[model samples]
Target: MDIEMKKYLTLLLSGMSLIGCASSDDLSLKQNILPLQTEVCCESASHFPWFRLQQNQDLDFELNASSPVNQFDGSKSYFSAFTFAQQSGLVEIRLRSLMLDGEVAIPQVELLDSEFNVVKTIDDAFTVKFSDAFAKNRYELTEKVDTVKTPYMIVYVKTSELGKKVVVPHPAKIRAQESGEPMPIVTDPTYLASNNGHFSLSVETITLSGYNQKSLVEAKPEEVAVVQKPAQPAIQAIPETQSYYHNAIRQAVESNNIDKALSLLDEAKALNIEGAQEVFVRAVNAK
Candidate 1:
């Protein structure tokens, strides 16, 4: 080869070697971030607790000072980790933290594959505030993960979300709305965000057959059995009272005292003397 061509090939090989070194350095840095202790907590994917999440079952957990701290991103925070059981399908995860004394945890999730590699990072969880009569107000996060591809998950609060507050309508307003009463104007309550708190996690598996069945059931109108009420016994008229009112109204009408006949009709109607109003109407029509 020419001298110039030889020089160009040498430069290209040097650049390729530098690129390989940089890639190796990045991998090593990632491996070094794994937590040293495996028994106590999950700083690494393989060290995560084996959690057999049943379909539509909720698992309650608490993160306090004793919880394991993760500093994988250069910020110290507590986290909960789990590895799904075999046969887990398309999984829907719901995380909830009740607002206790105006404090709660803001949760973010990371989905990892079986090989301890992160497949997806769900940092932007759409959180919402929920209140119900049976429980205290709480914050909820719902996200779906295909467990067949990503079977591991980690729940944690990012450092940026720490000290943030979630504003929600006051409990008084919610109570008023639920009770169908006039709502009172009150300042909205705020929940202080923290990295450690009490939370519950629920998992639901979705299958095509199950979803189709549910849709069909919902689309079908509910059957309401026609309940025929038994007929009430007829009220027998008191012959004496009925005769007295009828005779009085007819006599007044015959005497050309139409006003008196109408007055008598009103009294009979107040007394519930049946057929009195009909007699008055017939007399008026005839005249």
Candidate 2:
């Protein structure tokens, strides 16, 4: 083959290889956290679903869970999770209860084994010492003896009876992020486990929604073309911006203030401030 033909063929093959690599990368398998959907786990009638999240990286969580379907007699059992990373030494959490129920009954937090046996009870830290209103602040739990070797964790919580059945708004938040070391954030111990366990044990196996993270991929295209008008440019001190007529016209045009600009042009025309035709054009296009 001629040197010229060989060179052209080599360039074409290289280009094809690059394109193939790009297409493969785009289609490669990559796991990612999807958009979170929080559902409640209830007893007797219904219960909130257990959510699963990988340890480490952060995902935006919305704690806006639905209220109990049956307020007369309703109890919930939910299991939220975080996978243990190799370097995961501590699990940090920020637990808060919603005020929909009108009152607050602190829930129980337990670290369970693969078989769902309680390894140890993790305390839900409260801000105030002696009060029903427990502040949802940061809490950290570190492995005292050695690292928790549970391959599968069942971070469990069951709803309580507050003397009377009080309906709550959103489900209580049970956030646990893997921390290699202790964070510098300060925490207050408001409630202790040996302090307050659940009113009763878990009644039965209630299956709620499982946390299935939606992958973060290319955004879906919109059907309609969205034309976002740019912000109104600040009025300058130049001739176009200085004159009351010009300023009013520009503001109107930029901010869809066409009527006001027309009114200003009418007033300017009445005043006869020179060149009626040029003034109208300049006022209309107040760049």
Candidate 3:
């Protein structure tokens, strides 16, 4: 090669070496940023502990502690869209955290419209605790009229404290408007704990003809009342004396008082109660 060409080649080699080193440095930096623990899991539909949007037309979100991270290492955080729905340009969204071992500082919640476009963003700082035994949060957002378009959406949950950041994911998809489907009667006792003590929350359009309205929260008192239906009715099948005893047994089971249930069964057995077998089964199941 000519001397000039040889010099050009030498310079090119040096530049390529520097570029490779920079790329390696970048990879290392990312590794360092991830959490040290392994097995970080974020929320997903299959493993999600809790999530519900009253209205299929409304936006709702919940964060999970499980996040799929790099190497399935607990250090990496993941994100998934919990709920995304918009019809007639109005949308309501709710987001909450399930709590973690230590306090978690959540920094942002994002909303992606149809077509994977980022339509809304909210900034908030909150700490969550699973040990609280209850969700101590309720955040909401209202968006203007817009058709549901995004098939793939994501929620960005992150906390920046001690110069470290952790994110969890919950991917979301669009579904048919919930208006046609009958709203489930909130008769399940478990629904209250899962839905922030609200037996039901709905997402519906305000205007029937125009897209000039907002999404509103809809709930029915009947739903709550049904869930709170008295236990007296459940034991009505038995005689008066037996009904009283059965009521006590049901209460013990409901309270998760296994010992009490067993004790009540023994008490009935001593009296040669006719339903001793059924009562014993109920007591065993209570435990």
What number of clashing residue pairs does each candidate have, in the order they appear? 0, 16, 27
lDDT accuracy of residue 121 in candidate 1:
77
In TM-score terms, which candidate is top?
1
lDDT per residue for candidate 3 within 159-195, as digits (tens), equals 3332232332211111112245544433211101110
Model 1 lDDT tens row, 1-287 = 34653454355445545545565335323322222221233345554333444455656775543334555456655566665544556777887777776667766677877676777877666456667753467767787877767767777665576657778888788889989999898998776676556777777877322322211001111010112221231234345446645765665554454555665666566656788877765654454
lDDT of each: 0.57, 0.30, 0.34
Candidate 3, after superposition: displacement of residue 151 in Å?
7.3
TM-score against native, each model: 0.52, 0.27, 0.30
lDDT of 3 at 160: 34
Candidate ordering by lDDT (highest first): 1, 3, 2
Off by over 4 Å in 3: 1-65, 68-76, 86-88, 98-102, 105-107, 125-153, 161-287
Using lDDT as the yardstick, the better of models 1 and 3 is: 1
* Model 3 lDDT at residue 272: 47
Instruction: Order the candidates by TM-score, highest first.
Output: 1, 3, 2
Candidate 2 wrongly placed segments (more than 4 Å): 1-76, 92-94, 98-105, 123-147, 150-158, 163-287
- Sliding window of 10 residues with minimal summed lDDT for model 1: 216-225
Which should have the higher TM-score, number 1 or number 3? 1
Task: Tell me the lDDT of model 2 at 236.
Answer: 29
